[model samples]
Target: MGLEADDSSSPGETVMVVMDANRSRGNVHAIEWALRHVARRGHTVLVLGLLCEIGKRASCFPFHMGEKLERLGEGEVDPTELEEEIARKRDEYKSCLQPFYRHCKKNEVKLESKIAAGLCPRKVTVDEAQSCNTCWIILDSHLKKDKTYIYAHVCCNLALVKGKDVVTLMPSKVILQKSSLKHRRVDDALLSNEPITDDQEEKSITPPPKTCCWYPLAWRTGFPRYFTQSELEVITSGFSEENIVQTQDNVKVYQGQFQETPVLVNCFSQNDERFWSMLRILSRVRHRNILNIVGYCFTGSSMFLLFDFPFMGTLEINLQNDDLAEKILWKARWYIAVEIGACLRYLHEQCVDGLIVHLSVCSSNVIYPLGGSAMLANFMTAKCLKDGSPGDNQSLTHCLNLQEDDGIAIDVHDYGIFLLELITGRSARCSLDPDKEDLIDWALPAIEKGSLSEVRDPRLTDTTDDRLIHHMAQAALLCLQDLNRRISMSEVLAVVRGHEIARPGC
Candidate 1:
């Protein structure tokens, strides 16, 4: 059994817990003792129990173990049948636990239960825990092991497992009823019917403290355990407006540091919750061209993120600020393409969620480093598309409406904008008289007439890479077609890589 605490829990406050249902009644007795100790301290308790063991079958199967027997004689069935069964069992389990649920409800002791099917239990648990104010997890001492994999039996993969104070129930050492489950260690002053005052927050239980390991070079992947507001304040010197670089859409960027390492502080408002949610999801991903989030701070009304500083700034800045454009020579342009393409590939193939659309993938969102390399940043507008079809036009409508759908069409549209910048050396949006604006529309006439020269950047006169430019422009124009006919990121990458300029290290 293990316990977790929010910043404010009293030492003896009761905590909500989750456990596997298969555990013996004796095990439940031990957990009861632990819960009593927690409750005496003034906090309430809740428990969630699983009702089924879910596993994937080669072809397909049903959800409920009991009901699945009916389909056992059959070789296989539709995958949807399996999913439907799982959903049905989950509902039935909820009904079966209604008695306990009602008892807990009447006593003000919150409790929940459900069944989930997936190869990654830890991931599923983490997603669920994030939605609750769960304080701890109590699991059987039996260590579920498979070869080198040791399943995290408690807290599953919920971020709470990162808490330093996590308590583990060692099978050999713990005797549930035999040992004294003392309630003396808990403090009672923190619990109150009244809302928690701002002053009382500091004393609230801080997520168990964590040790940080600093590095000069960025790690390929991994997120910091905790990013406290105080630590960030100290690093940014109170985030004085002098350090402020930019602010838009509820996101504020400030300059800061950890020792000599330059960093950018991202502050967001309530409307920007989706951005933070996207970050939490993306934190699990890693790629050379995708800017990695170092740490994050989430407090009521105030949310901030920390990331490594890039010397070269964003592509938007380079396009608008003439002086910066000179620095982005042909070689730098090639590197950006390679890196961004690699990022798209990783997001498409490596992530379990399938496709990731950079809802706002204009040049402005790509950042370049002075030393070299480029990264795709600002995913607040990004979306995860389960099925990898980029030609689904409705995807754009979904993003605009804040609904869920395959965002491949959105990605193709953004790629078209990126192509325009590469060819015209201009922003995706026109600054020319507003009436004459719109890059896609402005270039459409020339592109359709086959007048490639009218759309080519004059600066490429001496570039031996003209053909490379031509091919990219063609690909870009093709992607600009109707959503039903737009090419996929995979196909676009192939055309870009076909250019001689994109040759290794070019």
Candidate 2:
């Protein structure tokens, strides 16, 4: 229950309200009433706080119980103690009133606070209202019993706010009514159309048809919360162009924020089988050097996979831009090779089920988070070759032989091309140039001649450690071998890490 407002309250007027500082919900509701029923834009809400001393009289206060209080403005009270108590109590009231500050600011209304400790709550409230020239004083429900006393002593118009405690509004239990022993549902239209029998009358009314609020459901492990298509729409802001981070082959990757954590959402135009395969692979895989899935979404005709938003985009972008390339020092470049190689090694050899091949490993698929090592990404073509046997290798035949280990060979070969791009700032394209030597053709001949400068990225400092580049070039040349002579990922990892000391092939 709440009290009535005075008819005299007008726009731009000052409103004086008394409420328990600790009960934030009730105080806000009481102020909301003042804003709506009395004050408007440009008005001022002057909140009055009364900190009563600890006594039998103070126990009557309906809010902020169990707090320490000291006698104020008393004959026996020390002056220093009174000042400290008043200052401390004012700060307490200030903090409790924080919720109102934002609400009042948005409404174009000014809010003020006045906190004082006293023995008589009624006398102190009336004196402050008069001194501030506030004629309409609003009382909290805590002071409902004192409303009569306030109304008589104070000359201003008064209203006692009887706010409903939150607990009082808890949902009540539902009760079911028993059907009559000889009753049945008899619609007027159906009763006139067909005659009813005694047996039918004895039956109870049939329940209404049930409905389902549809969403995707599945049992999964090593995955985050599964989102519906609708949730993804809100996350990506309806998949707007402004949220797009990158678009390849006209397929856009959107960047969005979820729960204050930035995420990248990959969209598919159709419910492609590749999307599910990627989802299944990403859900089970975890590594420091891999861009793991944050969550995923499913729909009738589309799908989405969410990952941690890459801060530094692709390794290709960093190497291609000379201004940004400087950030990737000799140490970072070596770090990138080792980290990506470890990720590939983990996928090719260390899986519990079988070797998983990331067939799409490339510079554009490598994400380099700021200050962190490189990460492997773009698993739309990844396959779980259980028992090291080939599944569908139709698309992989051009670059690999369809052997038991051919799928692993394909990834190893691409990883070599990845290493080449790491040393020489060039893109990873498998096709050779007929006009002249392509990046691979030009670099392979240069490495054999010991002319390392011909293939080194010009953006790198000349004073950098040449030993690092020498080892990387050797690993790349070994990886570029013919399919029959290709080495396993473990050997490739060893060569790049300078553990096996691979020699450049003639």
Compute each candidate's TM-score over C-alphas: 0.52, 0.51
Write model 1 residue lDDT over 234-341, tens digit each, in one string.
878897888888888767889988756678888887546565556644666655467777787777767777787877788878867766676666545654665576
Q: For residues 1-506, could you state the per-residue lDDT of candidate 2 as single tens digits? A: 33334344455666788865434333555566766665667778887766566332321222222244434333434446555655665667666677778877898888887655545576667666656555467778676545544543444555655553211010000101212332222111112222223222111112121111010011112235688877788888988889997877545799887655567888876745666677667766655577777788767667788877777789888887888887787766877788788788889876544568888888989986532557788887787776433434431222123354878888988888888888887876534446554777778788867788978888886655787888788888788855567578888877877777764343
Off by over 4 Å in 2: 1-223, 246-250, 387-402, 430-437, 503-506
Cα RMSD to the true fold for all candidates: 17.2, 27.4
lDDT of 1: 0.52
Tell how far residue 400 is off in model 1, in angstroms. 8.8
**What C-alpha lDDT do the candidate models reach, one value each?**
0.52, 0.63
Best by lDDT: 2
lDDT of 2 at 477: 78
